[model samples]
Target: MKFYNRETELEALSKMRDLSFKEHSQMTVLTGRRRIGKTSLILESCKGTDTVYLFVNRGNEAALCKSFAETIVREFDIFVPEETSFARLFTFLMELGERKKYNLIIDEFQEFFYINKVVYSQIQDIWDRYRKKTNVNLIISGSVYTLMNRIFKEYKEPLYGRADSLMKLSPFSTNVIKDILKDYKSDYSNDDLLALYTFTGGVPKYIELFMNQGATDIETMVDFMIRSESPFLSEGNILLIQEFGRKYGNYFSILTAIANGKNTIPEIEEALGDTSVTGHLKRLEEDYELIKKKRPIFAKEGTQTVRYEISDMFLRFWFRYFIKYNDLIESQNLPLLADIIKKDYPTYSGLTLEMYFRQKMMESHEFRNIGSWWEGKKSTEQNEIDIVGIYADDKRALVGEVKRQRKNFKPELFNAKVEAIRKKALFKYEIETKCLTLDDM
Candidate 1:
């Protein structure tokens, strides 16, 4: 439960703090998907400062105002009069902020805009009126991708030019998770660590589940996670719906289709029976931040040939195994679920190996850029390339494929990746080619 490793991010926070010590106020926007540990990073950053942590919820303006006032009162030891409204509540805080410097973190800030649309204007007014002398370091954090993006970056929004620094707290890299497990004396092997990355992709909360379940290996962890009543069993449902709203069911189906190898739009639509998924795909990529539209390596700017893939690892695994078997799980058909997991786990994990490879790439200093590349030339001519590592300069690149199976990467597998990369025009760039197994990586 204690913070383990966020040294680089903490250093960035320290820089922000130093900047806030100047005459002007400072604002940092921390954004990421749900459960990526934005709140934890901010709390760690505000360790010794005069910090007020206000979390906005799904409630009316008046309810949020009351909660804000109470938190401020408790945090700063401010005295409140008999009664107050939302405007008066913030006005008092503005006055106090002008007098003394403090760190204020507003978590789940998108909820405020939904509940009361004018809260941003009110804060902007107070900020414009009195921010010069406040010296307050404000960091607003949120998990809602579209709303939070609009709040900070949209030109028409009230807080458009307000941010001094932006930090998107991504999931921890595999090295960070390895450090945490080592610190906790968890003694898991490299393969076990890779397996964890396969399933969770370094989400701290999910890692903690395996830790708590005493799962020293992947099999036990899967057994613990796929149960009907486990916290993580239904976690993707809650997290995805929170980000994407009721439209999540459609997005989930699309993701499931993609994970199960229905890569093309037509293929995914036929598989899910959701002919309206074209519109759903647009929102899923642009708004919800769930899946990404990946073009081939040499795609032109106006290329319409692209593939949709789940952008998050846990969701990828969730849709692949858990969501597809939701009925059996809900009906408490444990034996059936277990049998499916046993039968298809390697197949599922062979796909998840891409995530584990990406994690390793992120941990390595050699690769400045890492992503996947594929070709969309043929209908049944499906070409797949797993991991692409671009070197530090624009001069060089490394094209590679990853397999999680125990067997060696045969000559055919390597040749297929090479052929696919050539079809993608990667050879035109003079890129190096490498075929990697889980062991080679």
Candidate 2:
């Protein structure tokens, strides 16, 4: 967990910081979901430099401002005796930036909405008036994805288009995770790696917690989760409740349906007692970015060949286990819940293996398009190809079948899937069929 990956983000942040210090004020906005290490990235960018870091906590606005004023004085050696208003303190900092350069990082910036709804407009006004004269490297970050995007990207919002650079931090890549697993457990198996990826999804905070506690395998990971005071138990609820707010019932139901394998619109609709879920699904995909809409490769735009999958590995596992077995958690039946998870981990982790390989192929960057190909209108899912990669050169394609072990891969049958897809989708190219297994980790 020693600050893996994010080299691109660090470079941009450094450039912006240097530009702000040399020229004038430059605003950098960072947005990502909870525990994506926004604060860590910001602080890392400010290493060996003078910085005033402020966290926007939910409370009285004046009290928050007073606390920030003290940090500003202590960090920047300024004479802010007591500024009770954030607007006044912010203006003071901007004015001070005109004389001296420093980094100013504001974490949980979206919390300003809860503290003082008018803070956004106030900052916008001050920023517009002082940006040309100030030399502060202002970095503001928020964990609430929807709110943060709206605050910065919406044309009508007060802080709209104010950022000199906007960066969204994603989870660590498959390579980073592998390096981390090697560091923690050198003898880790493919299943062990998959378990870590399946549960943590390369989220930094989760990786730190599990690896630091020596829970690098499936059983140990689940054991750590079900223990008292474990954040994994209610993490899914805590994460989405803040985003979905009062209208979370339907969203949670839709996500649960997806996690439980009711992947199609019709299936999810049937699971929800035939309630219309188009709007909710749209928001989940486009706004929340929780679930993904998938179609068979080479499928037409309006084709009736769509499926839905939860995009987050951890959330998918959480809904499948934590939400589905909430009765056990609520009743304090931790042992039984852990037992059920152990019983189901193999079947559950296999589906995650498919996703893992897809990501692995994506990370290769050799393919122009990558997806699975399955026949439409096939009620029996017998004719499906696991991984399909259309190379950027347009002369070759990769058709892969994923299995836990290479021994389970039937070459003849996989070749049959290759032929079917060739006649349907990749007839013009040479096909290379591969068996993507855990060893590929």
Best by TM-score: 2
| Lowest summed lDDT window (length 10), candidate 1 | 374-383
Among all windows of 10 consecutive residues in model 2, the one with the lowest summed lDDT is 374-383
Q: Candidate 2, residues 250-272: lDDT per residue as tens digits?
A: 99999999999999999999999
Estimate every model's Cα lDDT from 0 to 1: 0.76, 0.90
- Considering every candidate listed, which one attains the maximal lDDT? 2
What's model 2's lDDT at 57? 89
Q: Could you give candidate 1's per-residue lDDT for residues 1-441 as a string of tens digits?
A: 678687888999878876776666778899988788888889988888898888888877776777787888888787865333555676666667777778888889888777877878877887777667777788889988888899889999998988888888878876777776676556667667666777787888887777777764667777887677778778787787777676667777788898777777878889976586788888887877778876765567577777778888888877877888889888888768768876776667676667677667767777776777655544332366777777777667887766665465565766776776765566556678766665653
Instruction: For model 2, state the Cα shift of residue 440 in Å.
Output: 1.7
